[model samples]
Target: MTTKEIAQKYVELNRTGQHMQALEDLFAKDAVSIEPKGTPTEHAEGLDALKKKNEEFATMVEEMHGMEVSDPIVADNFFSCTMKMDVTLKGMPRNHMEEVCLYHVKDGKITSEQFFYTPPSMN
Candidate 1:
């Protein structure tokens, strides 16, 4: 897949509620993830750490009420999109979260990702 195709597929999968699958299919094994600064985990390197980080977030969410994925804007090897989520965390009330995610594709696979979002206060 080309950069555009990979970016599009990433959006399509997430829009269709296939979050995990998107990572599994589009990301490289040694991909790096950067979380917003001041977060518990600032960065995760490699697929294993990424998967574990995702699982940790999943465990925090009691329910995902709604989600919105914006169309990606692709440029060469980079793509970006905004995502909004309404979720209820374990023992916490529902909260609205928004993030702008930037991805870098190398050799037809996502090699790095950085997410910008406010840190949600967990009750």
Candidate 2:
């Protein structure tokens, strides 16, 4: 798939609550997920690690009020979109989290994804 195709499919999957499916279908075997420095999951390399990271995060959510994934803005082998989630995490107050999700695609598959967001402590 082209970068635009992959980006669009990714946004669609996230919007439809099929995040795991998106990862399985679009990511390269050695894809990497990069969270902000100092976070518990600062880096998850390889598809399996990425999947585990997502599962661990899901376990931390007490309630998901809503989620929104914007249409992607694609630019030659890269894409970006805004993601927002309203949720209450385990032992934490409900919060609105927003981030810029950037992805790098190579050879028609997503190779890396990095998210930019303010830490809850900084919010």
- Return the clash pairs for model 1, or none: none
lDDT scores of the candidates, listed in order: 0.92, 0.94
List the candidates' TM-scores in order. 0.94, 0.97
Where does candidate 2 have its weakest 10-residue lDDT segment? 114-123
For residues 1-123, write the lDDT of model 2, one tens digit per residue. 999999999999999999899999999999999999877799999999999999999998899999999989999899999999999988889999999999999998999999999867523
**Per-residue lDDT over 24-59 for candidate 1, one digit per residue giving the tens place of the 0 to 100 score:** 999999999999877778999999888888889898
In candidate 2, stretches whose alpha carbon ends up further than 4 angstroms from where it belongs are: none
Candidate 1 residue 85 Cα shift, in angstroms, is 0.1
Clashes of 2: 0
The Cα error of candidate 2 at residue 77, in Å, is: 0.5
Task: Give the best candidate by lDDT.
Answer: 2
Q: What TM value does model 1 have? A: 0.94
**Model 1 spans > 4 angstroms off:** none
Error of 2 at 56 (Å): 0.3
Cα-based lDDT at residue 85, candidate 1: 95
